[model samples]
Target: MKQWLVFPRQKVGLVCVGKPVRCSGQESCSNWRAISRTQILLHSFLLFTFLLSPIAAGAVDITQQLHRSLNSSVGRQSRDEADSLLSIGEQQYASGYADKTIASCLRALELYHSIDDLKAEGLTYNLLAKAYVQLGSLKEVEDSLRRGLAIARDTQDFQAQIFVLNNIGTFFLQQGESAAASKTVEDALAIAHGVKNIEGEGLSLSNLGLVAARLGDYNKAIKLYENALIFRRQTGDAIAEANTLNNLGDAYLASGNYQDTIATYGTAMQIAKTNRDRTNELRAIDGLVKAHSAVGRYERTFDLLEQPLTLAKELQNLREELKSFESYAQLYKQQGNYLTARNFYERAIILARTLEDSKQEVQLLDQLTKMLQLK
Candidate 1:
């Protein structure tokens, strides 16, 4: 028997034959999601067969063998393989491998959509948005979140809806849309409470705090972060816990609570070190520098700036590296060293351009022009 996959919108299709069917050509179509009644039964049988292995052997190898069995044709990998790849993507995201997370999530998304796993497909799109934001890929982030949020809304998956909404709110915050961000996170918080999802509740609370902080309501922001911290710590999610603490520190700094800012950022930095969370470590260091420098602790600020700069370079995080340079420029400007500050500003602008971060580049250029005028 032969399996000829005919995609109606295109001039070409793929061919597969025999047991453990191998596809003959590349495929990039969504029609595979239209499963017939018989095909569903066949897929269930294939999925069941893949789950059996009494080998008492290596964990991942068994999973690999199962993937081989179920991948009978193009766009037809089993849910298990897609799940495994998605798990890897999640780990890459937590460990700050933004580029790798994008690649893995893209692969998992394709497999999930082919299998009609709309929930996982939606989740993957949100995951890709998170990765894109880290790399400053603004357009990609917008597109991914748009797709993910639509899927979640259409499916009425409360958990997926909360995830997508929270992410969309965070994206809005980045774009300086404080009102939109607030409303979006409020929607997520309502869903989280209605669904009794603690993790989602925590995330929504944290995002709302970000909105409040951006709007200069430090008191409200801190209160939201504190509540979010309670839930996040209860769940033992170090990544999220550190994120909330970092944001809390920013609120403290903005409100002139320097002592609290130092303490909050110190704890975040400690957690980041223990978890090898390079991204959060950089952020924590940035907060710590601001707090110390605001209090005229230049001695500590110098070493603080150097550490994140080195770490950012090592991680190939162009955005953070440029930020480090910008921070150096700000510090020198504060000390009335215009020439040194101008040099650091130029360096940051070059890195920002390399990152294709027009927003950051333009901001840096403006600051540079203003600083030059001061002398």
Candidate 2:
């Protein structure tokens, strides 16, 4: 019978070796013996000492403090603080802190609405839509994006309209309504091309490419990605260029062109590192892992997974954590380490469930069931 044991480690019960060998969950717990009184004392001592250091708490509370400060301010200070909060919220949203992001963005929206800042209101709504999308609140996403889009159109702000359109299309794409997404994005693309807005065109093209890729049109996806890259370069948008390069890499990978996939991702990684775009850099690493795995490059796959895994843990990003787990699971599965694969898959399942990501949960469950059956 499988043993039911108490999780003695401080972090979580994430690390447990079987006949397959696992490591301690806590890095500091490994040197200790079983959960003895002395070991518990030592653990408490270490945790307290660590918390008292300069790096105590890892100090992420600064943002929350800032948010609090903004709430207490008035006039110019309030407006300025609100602007700062918006930036912080956008960063959090991009990093997948959906609930926190929504709170921050809503705070910003309150300030902007109080001041009658239509542009700011529109932008905040868009950010709110992004947060709702991450939370899988489809109705909230639709409402927020539509409100922003209406405002942008009413103001006749082409740039703002383009931004809202892109986000709206992305929302639809996330909902698996690709045809509607494509129509909305195509109109945005036409407008961008008409106004010669290179940045807008690049973004729209990338969205179009992603839509095509989701539809299994690898050739069209590749073409759109390449064209987007061209526009990105012409506009000196290195971030967008790197993103399109990564997308192209994915297209080639899907089509079984490992060499091209590797080369494309390599270029994207170089650019991402140069730009210090950790998000895109992690994306490139993910692509490298997939491409290398397709070619049976086990060592390369492990190496590729390590950077993103470390980064995700360091950043405490749930999205990156899930991606790292998936990558690890696939690599272990490919290497015939079914036990390790199951471990990572279980970790991913935990995260997916926390995020209420039904799609990912169902997919991971299917993989986990298949792997367990093989045992």
Candidate 3:
């Protein structure tokens, strides 16, 4: 449920259940031509590692209607048995068992389809979309979402429509189709407003903020995030609040408003800590370190980075770890410490290669080459 913004260069995205990653430089990021179609699938789906770690903020919960639909299906089969699989599939998805979720959902899908329960079948497709994303299967993701949307509309299930629309918007954002993303999210927003579903409102607003940010319209992004925050704060969901703040902090940083960036990131860190969300805590710390570094607070910058480096390694978030190395390289390069900077860049390149992020490896190498050239 991460809000995401895909750009041409410096590819800002997030990896947690939150937003998109942002690279350190403004170099062009045209991966489409060089990478295969399978790689393109990763483009829109892999934002969790680098964007701004918030899983899908305000994840759409199973509504009562959806529940009944799930429980009501399965002709000639044991009704209780099918319900159990559907329930287990939801549990598997929540537990991050991607393969299990897919298995459970596929089985459940057959039962629902056999019963001709469009609402239930549509919900199953939506469930499959979640599992497919983790597998980096964009083709499956698109197919699931399209089927879900069609079912939602055919059955006139307004709630299901809102859910499918919001998801479709996020998918478009990953595809780097901001215009389509915007339109799709706006449709969700309208439906949410009509239904008075505040969580939907917040999710749609936050996603629109991502679209705006991708378009380099920080002011608009900030406004949308603020509105989203208002709705989130009312929901008593601290994690969602922290995610929005992290995203808003990034927007502030992008706009050169360092003080606001610092404040926003600080708040995000606090909320993440209270929730014991180490991944998001790392994201907040990264934002703080970047803001501090940009304003020449070298001592504070290093201070801010140290713990997060350890935390990132602990989390096995290679991209976040690489980001810290890149930050170290940048800071040392600025201080005329070329040898130290080169060492950090080398480490980062290795990590990027391990992650199979060729673009990131190339970016790190470019930074290394530029630094050596200066020397």
What are the lDDT figures for the candidates, one per model?
0.66, 0.65, 0.69
Ranking by TM-score: 2, 1, 3
lDDT of 1: 0.66
Q: Estimated TM-score per prediction?
A: 0.70, 0.75, 0.68
**Displacement of the residue 165 alpha carbon in candidate 3, Å:** 2.5
- Model 1 over residues 224-302: C-alpha lDDT tens digits? 9999999888777786787778878888999999999999999999997898766567778888998999999999999
Model 2 agreement with the true structure over 230-287: per-residue lDDT tens digits: 7889877676677778778878999999999999999989997897767668878878
| RMSD of candidates 1 onward, in order | 13.9, 17.9, 9.6
- lDDT (10s digit) by residue, model 3, range 1-375: 343323222111211111112211122123111111222435332434322111224434343334343343345354445556767876665444557878988887777666666666776676787767755566676567666655665566676667677776776666666776688789889998999978778878988898898799999999999999999898887877887898899899999999999999999999988887665687789889889989999999989889778876775656568878988899899999999999999999998777666667777898899889998
CA error at residue 54 for candidate 3, angstroms: 11
Candidate 3 stretches greater than 4 Å from native: 5-141, 147-160, 174-176
lDDT of 2 at 304: 79
Residue 116 lDDT, candidate 2, scale 0-100: 63
TM-score of 1: 0.70
Judge candidate 1 at residue 160 and give its lDDT: 68
- The full ranking of all candidates by lDDT, starting with the best, is 3, 1, 2
